[model samples]
Target: MKDTSTGASSGEAVREGPDTFKRTALLALGALGIVYGDIGTSPLYALRECFTGPHGIAPTPQNVLGVLSLIFWTLLIIVSVKYLIFVMRADNRGEGGILALMALAMQRQRGQSTPVARPVLITLGIFGAALLYGDGLITPAITVLSAVEGLSVATPVFEPFIVPITLAILTVLFVVQRHGTARIGSLFGPVMCVWFFTLAALGVKELVHNPAVLSALSPVHGVMLLVHNGWHGFLVLGGVFLVVTGCEALYADMGHFGWKPIRWAWFSVVLPSLMLNYLGQGALLLRDASAARNPFYLLAPSWMLYPLVALSAVAGVIASQALISGAFSLTRQAMQLGYSPRMEVVHTSAEEMGQIYLPGINWALMVGVFTLVVTFRSSSALASAYGIAVSTTMVITSIMAYVVARERWGVSRALAIPVAGLFLTVELSLFSANAMKLADGGWFPLLLAVVIFTLMTTWKRGRAILAAKLRASSIPLKELLGSFGDHPPLRVSGTAIFMTGNAEGTPPALLHNLKHNKVLHEQVVLLTILSEDVPHVPGAERVVVEPLEQGFVRVVATYGFMENPSIPDVLKRCREKGLQFQLMGTSFFLGRETLIPTKRPGMAVWREALFSWMSRNARSATAYFRIPPNRVVELGSQVEL
Candidate 1:
């Protein structure tokens, strides 16, 4: 078995050097803008949705307290305990996400004598990751729609212009993605600080008048709500789950800022503000049940309403930005890990490798967001579509986390099972509640997830079949090199590098080049790039050189799934290993395979056709690998899959 451990093992300490108070505070503030955006902004609609949404219940004192109790405990147990404490600990070399956790769990399983069901875990992880794309779509739509909805509460005249204004705002948000957030990113922290403070202030204003609402903090109210309301109260969880919708963002973005900053931002600022705001909303409902229609916006005084709507809109944009950026990052990871087709990826910031913009992904999300906003029209309607994707993803994360705890942390099953069981029970209930909304717009995200999942699995399986076919037909590198002594081909002066998937086999490009051109280069380098399970591969261990007969060498470059592979960078590193290259003097030969759909034992004909279409549309290897287009030669071949 391969050594699956990235340099940092589970037992190793996370280095937080240069951890001055200023730096830590800055990081925590940054965490506030990015990590807490989704959850923090939940105050806009979560409480109001419970009483006024599709499955809303009457905001009687008992029901209000019950819903508030459920919201409070849900945040405490799920966000603070489940994600910040447990799931964040299962990081893959300081990276977190469904894919990262999946990789981590799979990596540990590779090292075990008695491995668990690998396929099941991978499928679940992929589906979970797919669900995030669905979440990404709905988050921006719902958050922005809810924020803009506040304008109507301020005055009914703004109701007619809400959708158009939202469309305009979303257009600007997606448009600015290409320029990157480096400049505006600094402002995110301070702006969010204002947002959170306003949230606390608004909540306190109401709480002073009705301190009786604080009793909902007791878990008994939440339990009693379910008991008294019975099935209807259980259905209230669908709306309640919205409070924790952004919880995954906390874990997914763990690598951007360390877990400590995320935790600090949560406990020190975000949690208190959110809880107070929620309790205040409950208090307002106690005083006036009619306020349940728009409790969040109603909390503001008459003069503050417009300003609060503006602030809510800005906060919504920030939250939307975070989710959109996450989608870009996730797409890149999927491409690198072989689960997605390659698309053009542009790095937006020189200092930040994580800042990337994918035109295809950006535009696709823009389209999805537009469809969602137009179809649902109102935030209350979109609320019916929201929680299903996130709840299902949470359940998947819990399962993957359980596997990581048992296999990687070496935690005994005795302790892990009950802990995992507790999370799963809560998550499943949330999922079950959301399931009731399947007919009322929840199908949208689930449908999108299914489509994406199909494409991903098709691409992965198709690539595997294609590689197997190529390896079967290709000659071994040793055999090809050994035959050179007996019958030497005409030697050219320049160095030729052929890229191949199989390190041990002669590249199809090389074979095609020799057969057609009838000549071999003075120096032949067969290069293969491998993506490891880790988040990053250290520079020193990136390139491996193996010399073969007659000036033939086999070079393998390894990259982590999180890193992009650059041919120029690999060659620069090669210089340290006694292999030098002149950019102009080197020719990169890549195979341009035309995939043919067939019924011969692999995938179904329709899937083969889909794979072929995807392969043809994928970004060229030359562009993706950052090889100079001027120094490239493509050799064409046909492969049946």
Candidate 2:
């Protein structure tokens, strides 16, 4: 019982048939368009940057061989071994991402019911997610710029127009986001298929001229380059790091397409095409050292240069689209987990649950990207800011993965230590090499991560303080129910429901309604919506209803962090539990908090002010939960912390 509209299971199990197989194949094709777009386009600029970049080397026979060997090994160890094989296995109920994996690991610890809590592990994962926002900003700027820069290689006149052309293409790309990708999504797989084939075809054409370049496949050459070149060779790693920038998508997208299809897509199509293209670039450089300035474009025949540039631009947009979608998904998960403020989330596709558009996030990213394009002015300059953010994220994933293996999987520390140690060693080396370029442009992502991390933590901590203050001032449920029975208020004829964060205590709205109106509804429902750490809560376990004294009913609605919360839908579930709903007869009461900052013990005055501002801007619960707007009544209260 798969619910195609929501992408969630409807029953105990998923149906398996020929239809399922076909569906999996289609998803795999789509994954190629979105998941592999960023990494696949690296051939356009990775090799060229290695030779002509700031730390560029001589395009000598030895240098070319060494660089090729490094590229091959990086793809094998980082993408193939670390992520596809090991990390993807640590999914949160078939969902994969650093945050999803973190939830899985935290659940494993909490299952023990121990007194000690692991806050540091949770903090590490949050910081990793924050870094991705920075990466999202840079991916579009660099990938699109690199693709358009290929035009400059054709003629000197096109060089002057490259920036303007890039800006125009990016403007259209971001503008169309509100319309959703479903209409054009079908074309992505086919277009990317052609793009990769062209990449392989160009590589094969050059490799046929000088097949000896294949010798670079051996590890010895890569090692020799580093040993002989010393400091200069070490600096080349900054450029080499570009080849694997999009590796994170492989894991992040596992929820959309299963691990099996992604693995199949990788070994069968993406890996081979990428290797051949890089090898082809190496062969081209060996034949003519001067081609190092733009070896990727040089591999193409004179007649095909313009068409190739056109195709490359499309691929760049596809890459940026995937990053933008991923950001929306991550933000939703964070809000559900109580780490962020509630915001408006619009579902863009009726058939696809994952297709969504966020106005706030979309505008913010557009501003950051356009600023980067104007500031950097060239692809190579923007490259300096790229690797550090992704590299740091990779290292953080490795450490967190080790914790999952040991604590969750019950693997022995002896085995997990060395296995994870190898990954950390390599990733830390890449991070340190990229760190050398901090003053150049690398500071941008780090600074962005710090600002976002502060905001996330502040929202989370502020909510905790607010809840504590409310609980301290509130009366227990039993005490309120007894008082209602003793001094029975005037009875109204309709039903009234009050939503509260704390289910065990009397809601502030309920108390206010009793005090001002001096009357109680014939049927009263105290409802609380609870978000679980898992992905989806089953229908049977979604609602818990209990009978209380004085005609009062307590209802708790549960949802997974990945699922959207809807009051109407939850009420339908309540109907199955023998509770009836009438649109006109039922009235929903909500409590709205106005945060007032003070020099309190909980947080600094400046942070409290920031939290108050965020609270004011967050979406209303009635709108976010999709309750009928006309049927809702809000009561306001001020709280100081």
Query: Quick one: best lDDT, which candidate?
Result: 1
Kindly list the per-residue Cα lDDT of model 1 for residues 1-641, writing each as its tens digit: 00111111222233445645555577778878887888888999999889988888999999999999999999999999999999999889878899999999999887572544888888998899899999999999999999999989988899899999999999999999889887787778789999999999999999999999999999999999999989999999999999999998888777777777778889999999999999999999999999998999999999998899899999999899899988988888888889999899898777777777899999999999999999999999999999999999999999999989988899999999999999999999999999999999999999999999999999999999999999998998778878887999999898999999998898999999989999999999999999998889998899999887788888999999888899888898888799866778999999999999999998999999999999999999989999999999999999988
The C-alpha RMSD in Å for every predicted model, in order, reads 3.3, 2.6
| Model 1 regions more than 4 Å off | 1-19, 111-116
Task: Give the clashing residue pairs of candidate 2, or none.
Answer: none
Among the numbered candidates, top TM-score falls to: 1
Model 2 agreement with the true structure over 339-446: per-residue lDDT tens digits: 889988888888887777778888899999999999998888888888999999999889888888988888998899999988988888789889987888999999
Q: Give residue 578's lDDT in candidate 1 (0 to 100).
A: 92
* Residue 25 of model 1, lDDT score: 70
lDDT score, candidate 1, position 442? 94
Candidate 1 residue-wise lDDT at 316: 95
Consecutive 10-residue window with the lowest summed lDDT within model 2? 1-10
Clashing pairs in 1: none
lDDT scores in order? 0.89, 0.86
